[model samples]
Target: MKKILIPIWLLGLAAGCQEAPVEASFAASETAVRFVGAGPAATRTVVEADGTEISVVWGSDDVIGIFGRGATAGNNYPYAAAPERNEPSQCTFASTDMDKIFKWNRGEQAFYAYYPYAEDADAEPNALPVVLPTQQMQNGPGSTEHLAGLGVMKAAPVTRVFSEEDPAPVGFTFRNLFAMVEIRLKMAPGTAVDVPVRRIRLLSEAAPLTIGAGTVDLTAPVADDPLDITDGKKEAVLVFGEQPVLNKTDYQSFWLMLAPGRHPEGTLALEVTAIDNSTCTTTLPAVAFKANCNYRQDAALSLDEFVPAEAFNATAAVTECRVGEPVVFALSGEAETVDFYSGEKFHQWEYADKDRLEYSDVFFSFRAQMQGGAQLHPLTVKVSTDFDGTFEEPNILTAAWTDVTTRFTLPTKPWTANNGPNTLERYLEEGRMISSGEVNLSAYYDEKSPYLYVAFFYHVDKYDATLKNSRPGIWFTDIMAVRAEGDTRIPILSQTKETVHIVNGDKYAEGEAGSDWQGTPYEYNGTTISPLRMWCVNNPPGDRDAYAVTNKLERKVSNFGPDKPESVKGGGNGDAPRLQLRVCGTGNLRNRTGGPEQDAHRRNGNGLPLYGDGKTLRS
Candidate 1:
C-alpha cells in the first residue's frame, strides 16, 4: 500500500476548515440530531443500528405518532431531507457543526444526504454500488487505436453521461504499473464534463530492500515515444496539467533508465496532484493516478567489470589460429565492460610484416620439412595484445598445439626432427608412437614462461606453428603454456604438464623478454611464487666445498661430491644440484671440477659445469 505522511495543512481534504475532532463533538447536541452511543451511558458512543461507524446526526422521527414524545411536534423538528421509507430523514449535524462546514457545501453548491451507517458498504467488489463513472475520452486530434473497439471495451460505452434528469457518481479504474486503482468522482448535469487534466501520476510499487535499502529515485523522462505513448505507430502526445489527460483512449506513460541497485519513491514520486490556478501546484493523492506508470526489464548494462562476450564476439572472432584456438567466454552484465580471458591473446598473430593464424581457428594444420638429424626446434607464435602483466596470474604459458606429429607409415629413415623454421615435426618412424594420435613436441622458448596457453571449445588439433605461419586459415584447438619471457637468464626452456625441459642458457633476440612465476629464483607453491632455497646462498665462503678442475673439462665439486653425501646420514642434500655430469671416454683433459674462477664463486662454492673453451661461470 502506498502511504503519504505530511502536515495536515498539506492535504486539501478540509480546504478552509479549521475545526478539530473535539470541536465537532461539543456542537453535536445543538442541532436536532442526537449523538447516539451503542452501549451503556458511560461507555456508549454513537452507533448506527447496523453497528457501522456513526457520527453526530439527527435521527428519524418515524415513531413520533406512536411514541408520544411531542409526536406531532417532533415530526418536522429541523432541516432534514424527507426519508425514503415514509420515515423522517436522519442527518449528521456536520452540516451545521462548524462555520466552514456550511460554507463549503454552499460554495461547492453540493447536496449531501447523511444516512444511518450501512454495514458491508465498504468497497466490496460484488456490491457494484453506483459510484462515480469517470472514464471520459476527449475526442482528441488524431485517430485513436481503440476506435474499432479492437482491444478492450474500456469503462463505459456511452462516453459521457449528463445529470439532465437523473444523476449519479461514477468510479474509474486504470492500470498503473502492477497496481489497479479506482477513483471516486461526482458528475453533474450540463457541465460539459470534459476537464482536461495535464499531469497524472500513480503511486509507485512497494520498494524492495534487497535491490536496495531506502527509496531510490528513478526518473523516467517522458517525451513523445511511439512505443510507449502510442502502439508503436503514433507520435507521443504532449500534456501539461497537474493531472494527466487520458488520451482519446486509455494511456499515459512513464519510462526511464536507472543505475544498478537503485529504486526511487517518496519525493521523487509519481501521481496526480491538485494544481493551483496561477502557480499550478497541487495535492497528490496517496493512491491511484489519473495517467501513467510502468516497469521494464533488461534496460541497463554495467561497465564496472570486464568486456562482455557480446562485445568480444563483435570484436574478436578468432579468424585465425596456429596450434589451438581461443574459447570465447562471455562476461556479459550491467558492467561497463566485463572481461574474462584465457590469457585472452590475439587470434591473429602478426610478426615480421606477415600474419600467422590469420582467418583461422585456434589450431591450424601444416606439413613440416625437416632436414636430417635436426631433432630439436623452436616454436614461436606472434600475438597481438598482452593482458598478462608479465604473466602474473598464470603458472605456465602455453599455446593450443595442433598434434602436428602425425607420422606416416613406417619410414625407412631413423633420423631426428629439427624445429628449425622449415622443420615442423620430428619423431621415430616405426612404432605405436605414430598411432598414439598425440604429439609430444620438443619446442623451445627463450622465456621463463611455459610456451603459450591455449583453450579450445572443441578437441585437440594438430599443432603446426609453421601452418599458422604459412597458411591463412588455421583453427585453435586448445590452450598450451610456455614460460613467460622477461629479463630471465634461464632460456631454451620447454615445459609441459609434467617435467620442465631446458637447453642450458638459451638466448633470444634483443627485445624478447618475458617471465614465468615458476622460473628462475621463484617456484609456484599453489598460491604465489616463493624463492627456491637452493638459490638462497648462490655463493659461499672459503672451505664451504672443495672444488677441483679436471682435464675432461668437467668441473666437479670434490667436497660436496659423491663421497661426502655417502658419509652424511641424510635422505639427500637439501641444496644439492640434482644435475648429472659425465666425461667422454677419451677425456679431453677432464678436471675434478671447474667453474668461473671469480672470488665470489670460489669463496661461496656455488660451482657448476663449465666448458674449458671459457673460464669459470656463474650458476
Candidate 2:
C-alpha cells in the first residue's frame, strides 16, 4: 500500500493563499506534554525534551501521538482512559512544528525537520481525502510541547526573494550548521514564487528586532535556523559550501525571517558571496540533451550517497522546455546495455473504482541510438492529450529531426462518471469541477509539483471502442511521473474538483527500508524484449501494435478511509476508478539491463550510497 499526505496549501493552482498569522491564541499556560519518542529497543525510555520516564520503547520507533492522550479509568486499575477530544495532531521529522519531529539533529540542536517533499515518482492519480486528527489525544505530558497560545503567530513574510538584481543589500553572520546552503530557490513556472532567506551579518549591534520569544534580532546573536522561501524567482545555490568556513572562515547565511520594507536598523550591509545573482540562461548544454532521461526515483533518498546529478528525470513533467528543444536526461549512470524491453506504467489498485474516473490521454514514443562514441541513448520525446479515435501508433524511429516532437491521438470521448468503462474524467470546463472559475488539475502541475506525470483513468467500458483500445481501456497513461528536483512528491485526493495526482511540496528522505534497492530486471521475448515484471504480469507485444498496460504505483488501501467499501469499486460509482494502460515499445526500457539485486537495477548517475561494503542503498 502506498501512503502519502498532501498539504492542501501544497496542492491546487494557487497555494492556499499565503498563510496569514492565526489570531486565535492557544494558551501555552494551559498546555502540558509528557513526551515519549520510541526507538529500536523494547524499553520505552524517557527523553530530555519532555523530562519524563514513563515508558521507553525501541525498534518500534515512531511518534506515537501528540496533542493529548486518554486518561485512566479505575483509581488503582493503572490503565485508565482519559476523556477529552484533542482534534488534529502531527508526527513529522521536519519543520519547526515539533509535532512533526524526525530524528533530532544533535549538531543543530533542533528537530530533524522533514518538512514537505518536492516530488516526482511513480504514483497513482488519486488524492486520498485529507485526514486530520479527530481522536482526542491522551491529555498528558505533550499538551504543553507546542508553542500554543498567543493565537497562531503570524509568520514573517519572505524578506528578499527577489530584489533589484544589482546592489541587492545582503550581509552574512556565522553559524556552523547547514551542511548544504543554497542561494536561489527554484520556482514552478507561472506560479509567482518569492525568495526568502536568513540574514547573514558579520557586525553586531546593540539594538535588534524581537520577532518572537526565544527568537531575537541581530541585537544579540543568531538564533533562527532553516531559511524561509518566497514564491518563485529565488536565488540559485552557486556554491554548495566547499569547506567548513564559519568556525574558521567569515561566511554565514542569515537565519531570521525579515519582514517586507527595506533593511531594518543594525541589519544592513549584506554580503556578496552569500547572495546568488546568477541568471537562468538556456545555453542548450554544450551537447544535445534529454529532458527527463533520469527515471523518477524516491526523494529524501540518495543514489550512491547523495543522488543522481539531478534527482527527477521526466520530460513530460517539465514547464520550461522550449518546444522542439533537445531535452536530455542523465539517469544515475551508464546503462549496462540498452535492453530494448517492456515496462509497467501502472501498478495494482487498493481502492476499486465503481464510479469511473477521467484523465488526459497522453502517448509516449522514443528510440535509442549511439552518440558521441559513448553509448549515448538519446530518447527524445513529446506528448499530447490528442487521443484521436485511432488506437496503436506507428514507429517513431524514422524521425526527420532529432527532437521531442512525436505526436499521437487523444481521448475525446465524453466523460461518463461510471458507465462501466475505464477512462479519465475530462476537463469539465465548468463550475464545481474543472471550470472556468478556478484552475483545473493541470494548472497545479509544473508550478506546484513542477516535475511529475499526471495519469488519467475512467471505467472499463467494453462497448466503447476507446475503452478497448489496448487492455481494459479503463486505465491509461496520461503523463509520465515527475516533480521538481527540490520538492518532495506527495499523493493527494480532492472531491471538490474530482481530481487526484502527485504534488511537489518540500524536500524529504525515503525510508531506508522502503528504498527500491533490489533494483529492476528485464528479459527477452522472441524478437520482443522487456523488463522483469515487478508490478504486473508481462505479455510481449504480439506485434508492434500489441502491449499491456498496468498501474505500477504501490498504492495503500488504508488511504481510502473507513467509509470506503471493503472491496474496491470494481464496477460502481462508490468504487475507485481504475486505468488500463501500456508503455510504448520503441525504447530500451523493455529489455532493461541487470542490477546488483538481480532484476535490472537503477544506478546513481551521480554515484552515492557511499560505495564499498554498503548495506542497502543506505550503505
What do the candidate models score in CA lDDT, each in turn?
A: 0.19, 0.19
Supply candidate 1's per-residue lDDT for 461: 18
**What are the per-residue Cα lDDT tens digits for candidate 1 across 255-318?**
2211111223332233332221111112332321111111211111111211111111111212
Q: Give TM-scores for every candidate, taking all chains together and pairing residue i with residue i.
A: 0.15, 0.13
Clashes (N, CA, C under 3 Å) per candidate? 128, 176
Query: What does the lDDT read for residue 452 in candidate 1?
Result: 33
Given candidate 1, what's the lDDT at residue 423?
11
Best by TM-score: 1
List RMSD in Å for every model shown. 34.8, 31.9
- Whole-structure CA lDDT of model 2: 0.19
Q: Report the Cα lDDT for candidate 1.
A: 0.19
Which ranges of candidate 1 are over 4 A from the true structure?
1-200, 203-369, 375-619
* lDDT (10s digit) by residue, model 2, range 85-194: 33111111112244332221112111110101112211211110111111111122222111111101111211122222223211111121111111111222232323
